[model samples]
Target chain A: MRAFLIFTVFLAAASAEHCYKEIEKACDPTSNKADSTPINCNAKYGAIDGVQSALQKYVNDHIERSFEYLLMSTHYANYEKSREGFEKLFRGFSDSKWNTAIDLIKYITKRGGQMRFPEIDSEISSNEDYEMYELQSLAKSLDIEKTLAVEAHNIHGLAARRRNEFHDPEISSFIEEKFVHKQADDIRALSGHVADLTKLLDGRDSSLSLYLFDEYLQKL
Target chain B: MKSVVLATVFLTCVVFASAQLQCAQKKPNIPTDWIDMASPCVKKMRGQIQEELKASMQYLAMGAYFSRDTVNRPGFAKMFFQSASEERDHAIKLISYLLMRGELTRDISHMIKKNLVVPKTEWATGVEALKDALNLEATVTKKIRDVIKTCEDPKDSSNFNDYHLVDYLTGDFLEEQYHGQKEIASKISNLDKLMDKHGALGEFLFDKKISGGE
Candidate 1:
């Protein structure tokens, strides 16, 4: 009876954590996609030595960026009547970043990697001198988006290269699925903003334009 | 929108490259901190944000409980989810108000609170959950009142009574809290009476009403 109970528990766990490779169903239409998603909570699934830690670093970075977005929002708070709009944009961005970090942490845990509660870095990334102007702020934000996109692209590349070793592909695919496309959308959106802001400001500081531009940002 | 097109054309600037914005330069920094509220107010305000967050999480849990297949009360789930969203908005409003007071250094630095625990996950009936929500709003109201009490009193040794913060919470947060509490209590009373008469069928009908029978 004791052996049967233990066997049942083992069976349940085995069904729970079926590895991504193990979930390959023959004659499925998605064969070409081969999207590296785990079908079960793979108990034995583990990553290459450095891949999980690298993913951990990005998770921490996203968490840090979330606060940075908040700090940026705070800086924009004292601007004018437009503070409401800037406040809306940065706070929303902050929430979205935190949500992304949360997703990454779950993925890490799912892949059998330990999530490190690393002591948060206190440094904020907003440049008070540069970001004061709406145009400048958008440009700086565009730069941030560009940096994050590049980093996501690079990590996705890393995961893809390491896929030959088995567990690395799943890590790569997780990054690709979660981070890559979002970064692309963010970059596109921010680039549009930078262009629009540049056109609106045209090397001049106009209070009315700033307020109007901020209102537009609030919607996003 | 027509006026916007012409404005965009005229506003287009022939300035330094976008790359300059990425780097450091001496363009005058305009800070928003017109007045920094006292330290004590900052602490209390931060605590209130956490309280709001806790209430949001509890509502979220209640929503999930009602959403479960076994308990499947869509009306209750919808109401709780809406309440959760409302609570989150309240937290954001408090945070924004705190920032508006130019006390960003203390509050923004300690931004998110960790490990928010929702005390209740399951309920015996719809009345039980409604009662829990009523209790929650009352607790939140009391917390807001306590913050107001400390901020308003001159003898607290802080030597600074933040009239603006006190007025803001009382006029805004307290008003919302009272309305919310009254609505929840009324619902509980109605649900109790209905459940007592027709049992689960009454609950089913009440749930429809709560979910906006329209």
Candidate 2:
């Protein structure tokens, strides 16, 4: 019994040491952390040029969208009745985009890539998005959602195809694990809103039904 | 038929014009609110939210400064970035509270463009940055107290004194401010003592003790 307990303790220690080495291997391309067996950080995990640029571009895109949503959220919040609903919707989108961008930023550094985010001008409103009513703005937001979903899908395909040359499956796995489904979820929710709103008004933009819809949206 | 064609053109033009101007609701759209939280109190909260956001942007600037190639102190960079994120979270929490109280908030996202102007990017040293952070925490603490006072107004007819908001700000925001101030102060003093003995090298080594670390 004592021998079995000792064996278990030894196993735990070995596993812990292996985990530490794995993370240590994650950091530097110079030297392996383990004395027992060395792993190449750069050769194993370094993103190819194409993949790195794609990820960087994707991050930049998300950052732009995040700022765009921030503007839209504030624009919606200015209205009288639908303020609560549209504020929650657009602000939630902005938060999600910011989070994904930050995560991708960290992941880029992990893969030994430097980011070059172009300074975005905060003046995003060239169109009349500011004056868009609840249903109209929602329609626009749905379009944004569709674009994001399509982009995520395209990137997933790109990452998968690129993994044939280099062993960097992590990028594909990340998009698959983190983004693809989330984008789908966002699209589903936004599309639902668009359909409901369009049907609620029955092709009319101005109606009492819009106010009624606002109350329902506030609950969400 | 001539009259019908002219009417069709007129109707099309009318639709185009109204599409641009139709955002203005024809009917009254009065918002519903269960809570009696005064607009003054709500406005104060929003103002404080802007203050928190400004501080966040300032911390982000400090983080950027420390991360620069000429002044590469990853420890300080990491610390300031953490503070930036924390300040942002504080603003988010306050905003969430406002939403929960059923108080409507105006579009304050314009503050992003207004508040992100960081005039002094380069500090003399990490020590100077630490002092600035300490001072910032003190100022934010004072602001939080002012918010509490506004919320705790006895003369307001609501008579609830915005007790929940006061309790929340006192408990959560002020606690974080005090703890952060104390930590920054200790870091500054300890570094001062170290620098007196060993100068620049001491400051370098002192920065290595990064609670908000790489």
Candidate 3:
């Protein structure tokens, strides 16, 4: 019984750690466009000279980004909503959801449209109101922000140029209200949620439970 | 004796040659602090969230005691205890996560205790606190991703078995995002309706809604 149990354990271990070669074989994409690399699918580490060593960084990077996306989605949503409510209550702003719309647009431009920008753009553009008009104009400037925000072959020059891009009062005000100030609060809230979920997920096993927690509560 | 010695040397040479071939095939730097990089940051982040949840739990508990709603007072107290327990569980899990990663956990008890200052009256304050929690999950999700990246960087190959740490962390991160993205946000978005629907039962659900319905 003992020998059988030990053998079973070994078999389980073997199957569980069935390295990249096996993963690669199982997950062949149909088109040649399927670019499979170590970054895409590999156990982050393997034993090297009996020492554990990780070969790739993509998994970690993706996981981190996924969390960041969750944070941005939540906090920015709340911050924009709160700001809208607050502005309506305090600042006498006509559109309560203006900052949120603008914030989403800026996020899409900067972070590659994680929350469906085209749909958002149409939504903003189609809204026949003065606030929508102002936000629509802001959306047009996203191209310039993208341009001035990035540069080929130089980080410092790009920073300097982007600084010039925001030299305009309208752009500066939009950024300050929607992105910069709002981002700080969003970031704080995101950090708190990250902490909570990290603690919860780290403890639990079973993907099903994790999935449920994520689906209903965490909202990742 | 001579034959045995020769056989041993031959076996050693074969093993050495195989290992050499493997190493020479892929030259990825193994970092010493890789595990530390992944673990310490995660631990730190987990500590912060645990603290917030703990504080929120205490606040709710205190709020329940103070609120004049006698019908749900006992229920709310029960919910508060459950929340505190869950937060404690989270703290333990954070510690376990650190241990699994072969990293030491910094003492976060004091920090958590200090932050546990919730309002005594949470009839409405609890709702606000829950909103804060929803927002908190969003923030933590971002930092956890950074920790995963830091761990996976080709440069730092720490000694702790990072074999599936990536998958584990990835799974955890996805779960985190889901919890925040779907569940809490929905609750906060529909807070007014939820409050109106359950009445007394709503107080219990609002106070104690576990992620997995557990």
lDDT of 1 by residue, A68-136 (tens): 676567666742323667767777777787667656645554554555544432334332332344555
lDDT of 3 at B76: 36
Q: Candidate 3 on A1-220: residue-level lDDT in tens?
A: 9999999999878656665544565567752434443332322121211111110111112222222222222221221112122222111111112223323322222321111111111111222222111112123223322332232112222222344331223323433454444435434543454444344434323233333433443232
Cα lDDT tens digits, model 2, B1-214, are 9999999999998777644533346645555656678767877887897788668767766765665543556688778878877887787688667767755444444434422344455689878889998988898999999888888884566655788889999998898898889889988998878878687787677667773452
- Pick the winner on DockQ between candidates 2 and 3: 2
Ranking by lDDT: 2, 1, 3
Better-scoring candidate (lDDT), 1 or 2: 2
Q: What clash pairs does model 2 have?
A: none
* Position A114, candidate 3: lDDT: 18
Candidate 1: segments with Cα more than 4 A from true spot:
A1-72, A78-86, A94-184, A191-220, B1-36, B105-107, B154-158
Better of 2 and 3 by lDDT: 2
Which docking class does model 3 fall in? incorrect
Estimate, for each residue in B1-214, the C-alpha lDDT of model 3 and write its tens digit.
9999999999998776544411011222455454444444455445545454444344334423422232233333443444444444444444445545544323221222222333333335445655655555566566556556555652433434344656666786557566645765676566547776665566566555542343
TM-scores across all candidates?
0.55, 0.57, 0.30
Where is the poorest 10-residue window by lDDT in model 3 chain B?
A: B19-28
Identify the leading candidate in terms of DockQ.
Answer: 1
Q: Which candidate is the best by TM-score?
A: 2
* TM-score, model 3 to reference: 0.30
lDDT for each of the candidates? 0.68, 0.69, 0.38
